[model samples]
Target: MSTSDPRPALFDQWLPAEYRRRGDFTVLVVLVGIDTRSIELLSSTFMNVIGDETRWREVRQLFQSSETDWNGAAFFPVDSVIGPVPNDMARTQLRALEEKVRADRRVLNGGHFFDRKGRRLKVEEIVH
Candidate 1:
């Protein structure tokens, strides 16, 4: 998508300060698609293939991770809030969520989550 594309717009335009407070930056990178080699070239010419390759590896590791530091873990939406999804199922569940979003805007409003304490919370914005 172009920078002008509305679906996956720039981070600052969409994410709120609350989301950036902890600063793990993995989810940010993923949402921004910064690890994609083509997007990296489009985003900046100063960064070369080495940087992109490194980031690609890092991004892959994060997705393969079962657990991460608080900041990384914090990026994960609570399952009950989103569904009965287990933490290990994050990748598959997220793909489904993305597909649902593409199929219907109502799913954006439909998704919800529950915290460890069982508090109900809606997935207000994918990044918020």
Candidate 2:
């Protein structure tokens, strides 16, 4: 996907093999966008991966509108959340959540998360 594409493409590196058998997983998504200088986080959400289709649709709609310029998103499985928090807190929480998921053995080697246009974004492109 191009940087100007409003529809964000999804990526995940640690999806487990038994995801389909285990059903939906809860996650905290970090939306990203690229400007002239760097890739930046645009928004965050605490939601279920499969059950929150409406919410994901809303996010895409928002991106299509004039309100946002996001082009990509990454999802991380999180155990819980205390409602909306600041972006700084969300980033910190994401790290902790990743460790938790890793410890729980919920993450595995090669699995697909979700992709909008079948474009896999490079880590260097997303991480500033």
RMSD, one per candidate, in order: 15.5, 10.1
Q: Alpha carbon lDDT of residue 61, candidate 1?
A: 52
Q: Tell me the whole-model lDDT of each prediction, alpha carbons only.
A: 0.29, 0.46
Best by lDDT: 2
- Shift in Å, residue 114, candidate 1: 17
Clashes within 3 Å, all models in order = 6, 0
Off by over 4 Å in 2: 1-21, 50-59, 62-66, 79-118, 125-128
Give Cα distance to truth, residue 56, candidate 2, Å: 7.7
Q: Of the candidates shown, which would achieve the greatest TM-score relative to the real structure?
A: 2
Tell me the TM-score of each prediction against the true structure.
Answer: 0.24, 0.44
Per-residue CA lDDT of candidate 1, range 40-93, in tens?
A: 111100111111123223433544462422111112332233323443455555
